[model samples]
Target: MRELLYEILTSAGRRMNFEQTARLGNALGGLLWQALPGRRKLAVEAMVRHLGISKPEAGRLAKESFRHNARSFVEIMVTQRMDPRFLAEGVTFADPERVRFLAETKRPVIFATGHLGAWELQTGSLGAFEGKRKIVVVRRPKDQALHEVMMRLRTRPMVDVVPHRQAVMPVLRILRKGGMAAFLVDHNCTRDEAVFLPFLGQTAAVNLGPALLAVRARALVVPGFLVRAEDGRYVQHFDEPLDTASLEGERDEKVQATAEFYTRAVETYVRRYPEQWFWMHKRWKTRPPEEDGQPRA
Candidate 1:
C-alpha cells in the first residue's frame, strides 16, 4: 500500500512541470494540515515557544511549513527522475571556491545538515561537488517498505545509505578514507545518544553522532543547507568548517564542544528560514535529568 502510494505520487509528479507539481503538493499538504490536528497543534506550539510568536502567527507559519515540506518531497520525486546533470545545474553553491577546494583536496567531510529545504537534493548534489569520493547518508526509515522506495529514489553514482543504528563504523571508515557523510541532525534523539543543548531559543536534545564522527575521524565538520530561491532553484550554502584540531580537552569534552558548534550552525539557518524547517517534529521531547526532576548522575 505504501509503495503503491509512492508510485502513484512519483508517476504523477513526473508528468507535471515544476509549478504544477508544487501546486499539487501544496494542495495535499493543506488537506494534511486540516486532517492532522494533533500534529498541527504541535507545530504551532513549537513555533510559539521558540520564536516567541503569537499563536495566530505561529499557526500561519506552521501551515506554510507543512506546504513547503510537501512541496520539497514532490520536488525530489520529480527531480530524481530527471537527468543528474539537470539536477546538478539547478543547484548553485554559495561559496564555489570552498566547494572546489574540498573537491580538489578530496578532504574527508561530515555535513551536519537538518530537514531543511530540499534536504534530499542537498545531500544528493554532493556527488557533483566531490567527483569520486564516497557519499554515504545515514538514514533509515521506520517502515522497511518506505526505506526500499527511498533507496531506489536516492540511487545515484557513488552514493550509499547506512542504517542509522549501524552507521557508526561505516561512516567513520568512509570519513577516515577521505569520503563524505551527510547526517540530518535536527530530529529528536534518544536520551542515551544525545547531548542537551540550546536550540531555537529552547533546550533540546541534540544527537552527538555527527560531532563524534568528525572528532574520531579527524574530518572537517561542515554545516550545509540547501535553500530554495525565488526562481525555484536551490542555493547550496556551506558555512565555515569546524576544525577538530583546535578542540582541546578530554575526548568527551571535545565531542561536547563539537556538538555545540554544529548545533549553533543549524540554529542560524533555521532562524533565518523558519518556514523551511520540519517543525512537526518533537525536537524538545527529551528532557535533561534536571528538567525531569531526577537527581543528576
Candidate 2:
C-alpha cells in the first residue's frame, strides 16, 4: 500500500509545475499538522521550551513548519523529473568559496547538516554545482518499503544512499578514497553510544559516529545546510570546516568536542530559521545517564 501510494504521488508530482506542487504540499502539511495531535503537541512544546516563546507563537511556528516540511517533500518529488534549469531558479550559494576550497583539495570531507529546509536535495545540488559524484548520503527510513521508495525518488545521477545500520564502513571507505559523505546529524537513537550536547538550551543526545569516522579517516568536517530564503528560493550554505587537528585531547574528548561543534552549527541555522526545521521530531528523546531519577532543569 505504501509503495502504491508513493508511485501515484511521484507520477502526479512529475507533472506538476512549481506553484501547483507547492500548493499540494502546503495542503498536505496543514492537514497532517491537524491530524497528528500527539506530534503537534510535541512540536509545540519543543518550540516553547527551546525558543522561550509564548504558546501562541509556538503554535504559529508549528503550523508554518508543517507547511514548509510538506513543501520540501514535494520539492524533492518535483525536482526528480523537472529540468535542472527550472529547479535552480532563484537558488543562491551562501559560501561557494568554501565549497571550492573543499573541492580543490583531494582530502575527504564529512558534510554534516540537520533536517532543515530542502535537505533531501543537498547532495544532488552539491554534485551538480561541483561536477563531482563525491557524495554518499546516510539515510534512516522508517520502514523498508519507504526506504526503497526514497532511494528511487531521492538518489540523483551523482548521489547515493547508504542505510544507517551499514553506513559506517561504507562511509569510512568513501572518506579513505577522498570522497565525501553527507549526514543529517539531528536524529535520536536508542543506543547509549552518544555524546551529550547542549541543543536549543537543552541537553540532547548526539551520535558520535560522524566524529569517530572523521577521526579515524583523518577527514575534515564541513558543516552546512540548504535553507529556504525569504523570497521562497533555496540557498546552499557551506561553512568553514571544523578544525579537528587543533582539538588535542583524549579520544573521547575529541569525539565529544566534534559532536558539539556539529550541534552548535545546527543550532545556529535553526535559530535563524526557526519555522523551517523539523520541530516534530523527538530530538530530546533520550536523557543523560546522570539525569536518571532526577528531574530535568
Candidate 3:
C-alpha cells in the first residue's frame, strides 16, 4: 500500500514541471500543516525556545518550513525524471576558490551538513565539482518499501549511500583512501551514541559519528550547506575546515570537542535560515542523565 501510494505521487509529480510540482507541494504542505497540529505546535515551540522568537513569528516560520520541506521532497521526485547533468549544472558553489582547493587536495574530507535546503541535491551535485564518488551516510528507513523508494531517488552515478548502522568501517575505509564522505549531523541521536552539546540556544544530544570519524581518519571536517535561491537554483557553501590539530585531550574528549565545533557550524546556518531547517524533529528529546534525575553510570 505504501509503495502504491508513492508510485501514484511520483507518477503525478513526474508529469509536472519544477514550478508546477513546487506549487503542488506547497498545497500539500498547507494541508499537512493543518492535519498535523501537534507537529506544527512542536515546531513553533522549538523556535520560540531556541530562536527566542514570539509564538506568532515562530508559527509563521514553522508554516514556511513545512512548505519548503515539502517543495524539496517533490523536487526530489521530479529529479528522478530530469537529466542528471542538467540538475548538476543548476547548482553553483558560493566559494569557488575553496571548492577548487578541495577538489585539488588529496586529503580525506568529511562534509557535515543538516537537513537544510535542497540537501539531497547538494550531495548529488558534489560529483560535478569534486570529480569523485561521494560516500553518503544515512539512516535507512525501516520499511522495506520506503527504503527501496528512497534508494531509487537518492542513487546517482557518483554517489553511494551507506546505512548508519554499518557505516563505520565503510566510511573509515573510504576516508583512509583520501575519499570524501558526507553525514547529516542534525538529527537527534540515541543516548549511547550521542554527546550533549549546545545547539542553537539549548543543550541537545549530538551525533558523535562525524567528529569521531574525522578524528580517527584524520580527515578534514568541512561544514557545508546548500541553500535555495528565489530563482529555484542552489548555492552550495563550504566553510573552513575545523582545526582538528588544536584539539588536545583523551580520545573521548577530542571527540567531544570535535562534535562541539561542527555543531556550532551547523547552528550558524540554521539560525540564519530558520525556515529551511527540519524543525519537526525532536532535537532535544534525549536529556542528560542528571537532567532526568538519574545518576550517571
Report the Cα lDDT for candidate 1.
Answer: 0.80
TM-score of candidate 2 against the unseen true structure: 0.92
Q: Can you list the residue pairs that collide in candidate 2?
A: none
Deviating ranges (above 4 Å) for candidate 1: 8-10, 13-17, 79-84, 293-297
Query: On residues 123-165, what C-alpha lDDT tens digit does candidate 2 reach at each position?
Result: 5566533544455556566887777877777776656577767
Q: Estimate, for each residue in 104-154, the C-alpha lDDT of model 1 and write its tens digit.
A: 765678888888887867646676554555555656878887787677766
Q: Local error of candidate 1 at 155, Å?
A: 2.3
Candidate with more favorable, higher lDDT: 1 or 3:
3
Model 2 root-mean-square deviation: 2.1
Model 3, span 1-297: residue lDDT tens: 889988787677658876786798789889889999999998999999899999999999999899878877777765544455654566677888988888887888899999887676665656644566578888888898877777777776666788899899989888887788999998999888898898987788999988889899878888999888878777889999875656788988888888988899889999999999989878888987768775432
Q: Could you estimate the TM-score for every candidate? A: 0.91, 0.92, 0.91
Which structure is stronger by lDDT: 1 or 2? 1
In model 1, the worst 10-residue window by lDDT is 78-87
For model 2, the local distance difference test gives 0.79
